[model samples]
Target: MATIFTRIINREIPGHIIAEDDRFIAILDINPLVMGHTLVIPKEEVDYIFDLDEKTLGDLMLFAQKVGLAVEQAVPCLRIGISVIGLEVPHTHVHLIPMNSMGDINFSRPKMNPSGDELSAMAEKIRSFL
Candidate 1:
């Protein structure tokens, strides 16, 4: 079965996409930790990040770096924090979170419930930086 990230990559479900290349896609997290929180995922849908081939892993980071730069430009933050806690979903994903303080990227903290419109607007803002 296709993972939810694959569905989003294929447009099977709605996603607030910020950017995409032939290999990876960047989209806003629906239950975001912060305003510009984004997920960078490989279209191939490997179950674990470490399981990915060396080239793919390198490409993924490069892709995330591109998105992270845009997120920093579009969102107010001291820096973009990267995380790889692939427990909630089956597919490999990198979380690019905007952070001004240490708690900003805490997964233990409750996520923000932004409306779809809010997500879409945030997506557009991030895309504008790319």
Candidate 2:
């Protein structure tokens, strides 16, 4: 079975995509920790981040670096916080969250339920900077 991220990358499921290259895609998290929270994932459905080849792993972070810079420009926050607790989804992903404080990246906290419209707007905002 294809993972949800693959479904999104293939357009089998909807995703508010911020940026993507041939190897990876960055999209807004539907249930976000913060307004500009995004997930960066490889096109291949690898179950673990470390399991990726060194080149893919390095490329993933480089891709993420570009997205993180754009997210910082597009969103209002002290800085972008990165986390890789890959438990929520089977696909390996890096979370880029807008953070004004330490608690902003806390995964245990309740997630925000932003409307689809809100997510779409935010995605476009991030893309503008890309």
lDDT of 2 by residue, 1-130 (tens): 9989999999999999999999999999999989999999999999999999999999999999999999999999999999998887899999999999999999999999999999999999999999
Task: Flag regions of model 1 displaced more than 4 Å.
Answer: none
- Report the error of model 1 at residue 2, Å: 1.3
TM-scores, all candidates, are 0.98, 0.98
For 50-77, candidate 1 gives per-residue lDDT tens digits of 9999999999999999999999999999
Question: How many pairs collide in each candidate, listed in order?
Answer: 0, 0
Residue 44 lDDT in model 2?
A: 93
